[model samples]
Target chain A: MLIKSLAAEWLKMRKSYIWSILAALPAVSILIGTANYYANKSVLTNGWYSLWTQVSLFYGEFFLPVLIAICCAYLCRLEHFNKNWYQVMTAPVSRSAIFISKLAIAGIMMLIVQAFFLLLYFCAGKVLGLASPFPIETVGWMSRGLYASIAISAVQLALSIRIRSFAVPIGISICAAFIGLGMYVMKLGMFYPYSLLTIGIGALSQESLTIAENGLFLAMNSLFIVIVSAIAIRYLSKRDVVA
Target chain B: MNAIVSTHNLSKRYGDAYRVNEVNLEVHEGEVYGFLGPNGAGKSTTLKMLLGLVKPSSGKVVVFGKEFDKNRLSILRQTGSLIESPSYYGHLTGLENMRIMQRLHDVPDKNVCEALKIVRLENHKDKKAGLYSLGMKQRLGIAMALIAFPKLLILDEPTNGLDPAGIGEIRELIKSLPQRYGITVLLSSHLLSEIEQIATSVGIISDGKLLFQGSMEALQSKSQPRIAIKTVDNETAHVLLYRQGFHSVIEDDALIVKEMNDEQTAFANRMLVQAGIDVIRIEERRKSLERIFLELTGKEKSL
Candidate 1:
């Protein structure tokens, strides 16, 4: 059922500008990220780690959350346009199937954006002519960033589904990003859903993650995914598609 | 015939007022059940309840002999609906939108083109839905609902934006639905004559209540003939008609007397003249469906 819904979801996004936006945000992050890395390269030792230190922080903290939110908001924009929820709801699928299919599609879109970011980050490092051995830890940082992105995507999906206004979800995401940054500064980033990205990406950490920190990150992410996905699915199923 | 949709005491309340209050409705298989009501008269609410778009406040909705609460997906599998206004993807082209619906319904691609041809939108298939005129948009909506060729089709004022010829085509299409594809239709309309044209059974609702539900013959017999008289002296005619023990009410520029036949019309004319009141005209008129609709809804004064 979700596969069929995804097929349908892909058709809706064919001509939409969401593709450009998805590609553009990562480009912005890459541009800003490599620029800052090069400006401070004299004080840095490890080239790839130095590159990630700048790039992933900007992507994980700001661009990633808002991009996830916008992807969700645009994915649901069809439903908001011309009252398409009433049409989709009457299409013989269980309400849960409808909600989950949307989440799954949003997750796929999030992956696309994350992948684009990883590609751009690597390309920028190559362009900077960095000669240090490839920092395999960069893969862990990007994967964790993707994992934490799904958690944030769950909550953003819930918000976009409940609120018909598109701007509200994006606005809420902007505020939450700054708050997540605050939590990151306070050293309690591992506990908050918003700060999961900062902790996972090791943005504020002096060194790469320890085994203990990694376990905690994985545990917190799984718990958040289970609890938040359950809540979002329940809320969406119970909602009345009055439009 | 077995009922495809049966509602018992179905109601939806907002605040203290019932949007649909204790309405019991039955739509039998292979019949076009026309739900007739004026605006804000619970037509949309009742249809919404059946579609599960709006939850019923109380009562049961049984589709295909199973409760909607238990068999929602099953019920919806065989049913398609259009509520109030048509819904479409303005960004996608007409054909692309149809493809989306086809995928969502998990049906074959063949139905998409066939449905577009039925609505006569095959030529405009590549055009963006936002550019389609209101009538074209309405046809696209109908095409989407009919694309799956479901056994039951529920439409709320489906003829909204169409020319007279387009309406005629749609009426003919609806009439052929029962036998051509064995589709049972439950459509709501505020236009009495529209229902009179294609309905097999009619349900009249007003202020969230079902005022009448029966065959077309039953509705016609329920409303008897009346005399509509225009006179130079309406007040004098009323006084004279009252003296003769006849009931009459003064509408704008006309004196309407109920239950009047040819004999009563001649008698009223003779008596009005005998009482020195000039009778300008006395026309014997039959009760039209519109008149009966207004009478049933008690909105006679509402122009």
Candidate 2:
């Protein structure tokens, strides 16, 4: 059932702007980051780390949350816009399967987006002639970023599913991303799911997280996904889709 | 004919008002059950409960002789429905939309093609659903519902947005369904005429309650024909007709003598004239489905 649900979701999305979004956002970040790297090439000592610093800042601060929000919103848009909720809910499949299948697909799509961003980052570094060895640390940071995105996807998915309007969820994403930024500035990013992205990526600020802080980061991401996913499932279970 | 669907004292309330009262419904196999009501008469709500789109506030639904609440998925697997409006992915083509439903039902590609052909949408199967007109979309919705070869079909106002010719085509198709596929259908509509020609059984509802539920013949039998007599001496004709063991009233400029046939029509005309009250006109008028539907719902003022 999950496989069927996933297949249908993928087919529906493929016919829409999903691919363009996955490719476009990361490509934009890379191009902008490459331009920034060239402008400050004279003062930079370490090439890969400097490049990571410039690009990931934009990726973490602005693009990442919005990307997750748009994907999540777009994921629910077909059912919402087409008013197919009642049709879908009346199907033989369980709502839990439907909700989780969407969640699983969102996680997978975001993972692919993350992989694309990483590849773009590497290619952009080579294009800048930053021939230094790959800073394997950035891979660690992006893996952490993936965990944080799961957390955002869970809650954002819940919001997208609960609300029918397209722009509302994306609007919430923009405003919440700024709050995440504020929390990060206060060194309180560990408590907020949206803030976990920048903190996890080791972008925005250079201070290294203590091992204890790192454990907290992993725990928070796991906790948010579990709790928010539970809430989303509960919402779906109780939802009386009138469409 | 075994009962394929039965609801027991089902009801749905919002706040203090009843959207659907404690009404029981029975639909038999090999039946095209026409669910009829006027607008805002809880026709849609009743169908929604049967489809499991909205949970009932009280009572339960039984489909295929089992508890529907416990066997929801299995029951749904055998049931296909279109509630209120057509649902489609505008980005998908007509064939693609049918294909998606086939995937959900785990059916073959041939099912999609055949279902489209049934609705005559196979010609435009490649067109995007967004561009399809309302009638086309409605046909496509029926195609999707029919794709799985479901044992039972629940169509809510399926003929809502169709031309007269399209409506007649759909009527013929529905009339052929029980014999062609042996599919039992529960279809709801506010327009009595829409269902009158196709429904084997009719369930009439109004104001959150079931007013009448029986075979179409049984319902039509409820409409009593009367003798329509108009005379120059109206009051004298009234008194003279009453003297002959007939009760008559004036309706639409004619004297309406209830429950009378051809013999009585002639008898009343003779009686009125013999009493020096000349009869101007006398005719037997049988009530139409429209009249019975209006009277059944207590909205007789409506056509």
Instruction: State each model's TM-score restricted to chain B.
Output: 0.84, 0.94
Candidate 2 chain B least-lDDT 10 residues: B97-106
Q: Quickly count the clashes in candidate 2.
A: 0
| lDDT per residue as tens, model 1, A158-207 | 88888888989999998998999998888888888889888877665637
Go through the candidates in order and give each one's DockQ.
0.71, 0.65
lDDT of 2 by residue, B1-303 (tens): 799999999999989999899989999999999999889889888888887778899989999998987888899889989988898999999988877777677788888888999999989999999999999999999998898889999999999999999999999999899999999999999888888988999999999999999999999897777778898978777778888889889888888888886787777777778888877888878888887888889987654
TM-score of chain A, model 1? Answer: 0.92
True interface contacts reproduced, per candidate: 0.82, 0.53
Evaluated on CA atoms against the true complex, candidate 1 attains a DockQ of 0.71
Instruction: For residue B254, give model 1's deviation from the true position in Å.
Output: 9.7
Error of 2 at B211 (Å): 1.3
Candidate number of the best lDDT: 2
